[model samples]
Target: MKRFEDKRVLVTGGTRGVGAAIADAFAAEGAAVAVNGRSQQSVDRFLATRWGDFHGIPGAVGPRDACRAVVDAAVAALGGLDVLVANAGVFDELPFEQVTQEDFDRSMTVNLGGVFFCAQAALPALEESKGSIVATASDAGLISYAGAPAYSAAKGGVVSLVRSLAIGFAEVPVRVNCVCPGNVDTDMIREAGEASDDPAAYRAAAASRAPMRRMATPEEVAAAVLYLASDAAGFTTGVALPVDGGGVAGFD
Candidate 1:
């Protein structure tokens, strides 16, 4: 039998990028997966692919109501919840000097607050099943990144939040963890590069900065999520696993 046989999962931001890959991984492993996106259109497109056992759940994770709605829909559709992947997030570069209050609040609301409320919304079901939560943080959370102070701060909050949740849920014993990926090759990253004067050069520089000499594929990051959500990691909780190709090791 597949590792995730008979499991039910909900992945926020699952319509694209790292979330999409994580959703695919869960489905492939025999889980009934719910894919949440901001729009019904994007969710429908993903569901139309008929990839594994998937249901479309359309909602933005930024709002408290939407977070609860997504979880409620997932539970209704999938019968029960075995794992919650709080993967919805946005990214942008803004130097500390130029960072507006609006930009900072937006980043925190989506990146950190989204994860927090999503997990809270899924808490009852997870407690019932004693399941786990795996959030997508970033290497920026673990260390500093140039030109993305708001983004960095938001992710750093995610790491801390995961730890706190793990402790909070210890009585019920629901595990909470996060994955921190570095320089992933996704549409989000591509868009960032395109915003530069020379997209090609921008992309090249990003790849070169990684000690591994290449950006991580979304699949690679998904693999980490898979492990965290799996029974194989039953003993693991409150850990921030890095999938960053050694980029967080040191200055060198």
Candidate 2:
């Protein structure tokens, strides 16, 4: 049988990029997936095209009420929940001198706050199913990235939060883990490259910086999420598994 046959899953910020890849992977593995996005339009667009089997739950993950609503909706739609992938986040690149209160708040709210509240809201259903949670952190969480301090801080919180939740949910027998990816080839990274004065040079520099000599694909990161959520990782919890091409192995 396929690995996740008959399972139910919810993936936050799943309309695009790595989240979308994770959602698609679950669906392909025979799981019923509910995908959450900030807007109904984006969710509808995704479902109407490549991911029709996925139920789209449109809402922001930052607010506690929204996270609760999204999780409730997913459970109702899928009949139960087996996995929750808290992957909604934003990234910014700016000098520390230019970092504003708005920047820091937005980073923490969407990245760290989203993961916390989403998992909290999903806890009851997860306990019932003895399910698992896989959060998308970043290599920046393990090691600092010069231009994006707020992002690094938020993801670092995610890494720590996974550990706490793993222990917190031990009695419930729910596993919690996280994936820390390095540079990835996604629209987010493409936009970052376009923002640079020398787009091609910026892209090249990013690839060269990774020990693998290239950025990771979203599918590659999704595979890690799959393992963490599957029976293959039944004994694993509270791990911040790195999918970073050894980028975090040494200082850059």
Candidate 3:
């Protein structure tokens, strides 16, 4: 049988980017996947283009109620929750002094709170199913960088919370972990490069920054997520796995 054969999975912010890749990986492994996008329209668009069919659980999950609702909908749609991939997060690149209240709140609400409340709400089902949670953290969480203080802090919270949650859920044996990805060649990065005054130079800089001299693919990150969620990682929990190309290890 496939690794996740007959398992039920839910991926938040699975409409595009890394989230979409993770959802696809689970579905390919024979898991029933419920994908959550910020809205029904985005979810419809994602499903329309994707070759693999997935259950759509659309909602903007940041607030406590919103997170609960999204999880509840996923459980209702998939009949149960075996793996919850908390991939919904907002990223911003701005000067710290210019950061506004709305920006900070939005970052915390989506990146940290989304994971917290979603996991809290999914605990009962996951405990019963002996399931797991794999979140999408970032290099910002592991190490410091300029231009995105708020996002980094929120993701840092995610990293710390994953460890704590893993310890707390040890008795239930419901694993909790996260992936800290470095520079990824996603649409968001492409857009940033395109918007820059020198797109090629910007892309080149991003590539050269990583020790491996190239940005990671969303699928690569998804692969790590799959590993953590699979039985292969049965002994793993509370790990902040770095999927980055040695970015977290050293600057080099």
TM-score of each: 0.97, 0.97, 0.97
Q: What is the per-residue lDDT of model 3 for residues 1-252, given as tens digits with 9 covering 90 to 100?
A: 889988999999999999999999999999999999999999999899877648999999889999999999999988899999999988777789999999999999999999999999999999999999999999999896688899999999999999999999988899999999988888778887887789899899988888999999999999999999999999899999998888888757
- The global Cα lDDT (0 to 1) of model 3 is 0.92
Assess candidate 2 and give its TM-score to the true structure. Answer: 0.97
Q: Give per-residue lDDT, candidate 3, residue 60.
A: 95
C-alpha positional error of residue 57 in candidate 1 after TM-score superposition, expressed in Å: 0.4
- Per-residue lDDT tens digits for candidate 1, residues 9-112, read 99999999999999999998999999999999999998887757899999989778889999999999999899999999999897789988899888988898
lDDT winner:
2
Q: Name every residue pair that clashes in candidate 2.
A: none
Deviation in Å, model 3, residue 251 alpha carbon: 2.9
Worst 10 residues of 1 by lDDT: 45-54
Candidate 3, position 140, lDDT: 92
Clashes of 2: 0
lDDT of 2 by residue, 1-252 (tens): 989999999999999999999999999999999999999999998898774468999999887888899999999999989999999999999898899999989999999999999999999999999999999999999997889999999999999999999998977799999999998899888899999899899889888888888999999999999999999999999999999899988856
